[model samples]
Target: MENGILARRRRELITGAVVLAALAVLPLPIADVYTRNLIIITLLFAGLAQAWNILGGYCGQISLGHALYFGAGAYVATLLFVNAGFPPLIGMFVGGAVGGLLALLVGWPCFRLSGHYYAIATVVVGEIGYLLFLNWDYVGGATGVYVPFKGDSWLALQFKTQKLPYHYVTLAFAAAAWFAAWLIEGSRWGFAWRAVRDDVVAARSLGVRVFASKMAAAAISGFFTGLGGAIFAQYVGYIDPESVLGGQFSILIALPAVLGGVGTLWGPVVGAAVLMPVSELSRSYLGGSGRGFDLMLYGALIVVVALARPQGLVSLLGRRRERARAA
Candidate 1:
């Protein structure tokens, strides 16, 4: 047993090392700016999906309103930077806190209902936030606010030249998010969340505080999603309701988790890595021909994956490993 445990640890460490090494130099090989930009975008999406996974994946609570948290973070940082002259660096954390607070508000009423009812409630709450932002002129209304160009400065979260800084920042956060997930998987909270996931009634019978566990998961999940939003705002230097919030962003953010494997730690990252590049390619190729092509392709892929491999793309690796062991 000891030898087996050591071997697994050895394998995990090596796998982690290799992945980090590859991501470290990921941009060096890609000469095309469009492709590089697509990669950067993928990193951001990976973070968002991973954040969502904390609640949706582990807790088995499918939230279709994650865009609210994302937009909250973006708007918070932008409002502070633009109106209060506060550095976005500071505003990002505040935005994350706001996301957490909002999650508590949404989860308080919604957690009472499970499954699809919970999801529907989330969608409603998300739309409410979107409409409020759309009509509120203080936040630029439907037009949205833009981050000022104050030259390249880390404090301002602005970069004038290469996109390397942005990539590193995202990579760091993605790593941190992944690390958090990893820790949670081993912690008591993680066990409670998983218990609730497997059987909520049984978990409650076991003395688990089901509501509190769900609420904690939601708040933490929202906090990270909000951070992803703030990072995106800084990187793009612009924001709008259509671009930053709504069901589309929610779907896009969740796509990776759905495609990769919702409950698995590295699923979102792998899914985003695969999906983003393909979607970008479709956009590049079919963009001029007509509209909705990209959306159609994404929809088709999701349906096919659901039908053919309900366990998700990551299951393929597990199956291969099982086969190897049998062989």
Candidate 2:
């Protein structure tokens, strides 16, 4: 059994390396700025989705208001960089720390409730945060803040003429998120989280500190999510409440994990790879019509995927592998 587990771990690591290598070179041949930008956005969301999965998938917290952490990260990093001349490379870590702390704060009360009630509580908390940021003049309020150009320094994480750097940055972030998930999946916390997810009563009876497990998952999830948000704020160079802290943004964060395969490592990446391109393309080509056609198409695709592959697209990969082994 030990040898089998070690062998599987080695295989997973090898597979991850190959995938990362392919992604690293993917944008090299593509000259289209739009295509490269799309890839970056996809990678960013993949990381965010994986982050969400740590709590929502593995821990079964089902939070609908992750935007709070995301927005908090963006605001913290942006504020530090713009006001104090702090480098965003370091500010992002600060943002992530704030995000993790904020998650614990939010989880403290919300975790008392279970199932949909907890989810609803999160949405309320998230909306309250949005409202606060929108009204608070300290963070620029509704006017939003623009990340200034301070030459093309990597310390600032600003690349004026090149999109390639941002691509690599997001790719690294996504890779890091994946690696984190891989580590967590093999940890004792992972086992406890799965037990809690499967049945809270059973988990508690088995002497698992259910609350601690959930809280740990939330902190880790929020940290990575916030880091992703900081990267996004830097990449776009502008952020507002509607852009970062809105309810829709929460849905966007959770959708990939749900569509890919909750509780599975590869699920978020697969879902993001499929969803982001379709969304970008649909919005680009169909959004011009302005009759809500783009949204309609996007909604239809999601519904189709949900109805057709309820277990998520990642399940297809498992089935294929099983068939190959059988052959």
Candidate 3:
């Protein structure tokens, strides 16, 4: 039975790898600059979604304040690169460290709260970060900071000629984030996180350090998200308080988690694949026409999904897969 299970798992892994390899490469053939940029942004947000999943999904902590990490990552990397003349690759790690530290600082206090109080604390922490970013002129404040455009320095994280580079780079980050999630899902740490998520008191009774597990989750999540933010800032060639640390940024991060499946490793990627294209299409059709069609569509989609499938897309897909297997 164990051998059979291992064989089945190997088959599943091989199949998934083939599909993802195809998705990553095949899109290049038909990708115009516009489409390439769109997909890159989609992948970037997907990475963020997966990072958020670590704390929010695995740990069962609903944090609307992930924008703090995302924004901090972007700002720190951008500031170091543009102002301090630091290489972006090094800046990325530094930004990630900052984000991880911030996560520890915030999570240490907020994790003590239970249920809605924890949620509220996250929101407050995010708001504080936003306010500071908005007022801090050293990093462009409300106006924003523009990355200096170098001719062709890959080291500077600047690619002037093609969107293909951006696409591949962002895809790499997304793949890494997904791989990390998969590794964590089957590890001892993952089991502990799930235990704490299910019942903190029970987990504590069983000798699980609930706070430490949650903090570890937060740290890992922040690192991935911060790295993604560095890529995002470089792609945009600009970063600002409003664009980097805003509520919209948080929404973009969380929407995939909600749409796809919160707790599963593949949920964010699947969610981004399904939801992002629709959103982009809606914007193209309904945006800037003095109509709220896109907003209406988003609202409708959320309502329908919530009413019909509260467990989310992953759960729905799992049910279908089981039925097919049984048949």
Best by the TM-score measure: 2
Better of 2 and 3 by lDDT: 2
lDDT scores in order: 0.87, 0.94, 0.83
> Model 3 clash pairs?
none
TM-score of each: 0.95, 0.98, 0.94
Our tally of clashes for model 2 stands at: 0
Q: Which sections of candidate 3 miss by over 4 Å?
A: 1-12, 325-327
Q: Which ten residues in a row have the lowest lDDT in candidate 3?
A: 4-13
Query: For residues 1-327, could you state the per-residue lDDT of candidate 2 as single tens digits?
Result: 799777887888899999999999999999999999999999999999999999999899999999999999999999999999999999998998999999999999899898999999999999999999999999999999999999998999999889999999999999998999999888999999999999999999999999999999999999998999999999999999999999999999999999999999999999999989989998989889887898898888788889999978999988998899799
Cα error, residue 280 of model 1, in Å, equals 0.9
lDDT of 2 at 24: 96
Candidate 1 global CA lDDT score: 0.87
Query: Which parts of model 2 have CA positions greater than 4 angstroms off?
Result: none
Q: Put the candidates in TM-score order, highest first.
A: 2, 1, 3
Comparison by lDDT, 1 against 3, better one: 1
Best by the lDDT measure: 2
Candidate 3 residue lDDT tens string, 104-202: 889999998988898889888988999998998887789999998986677788888778777777888888788777777767898899998899999
Which residue pairs does candidate 1 place in steric collision?
none
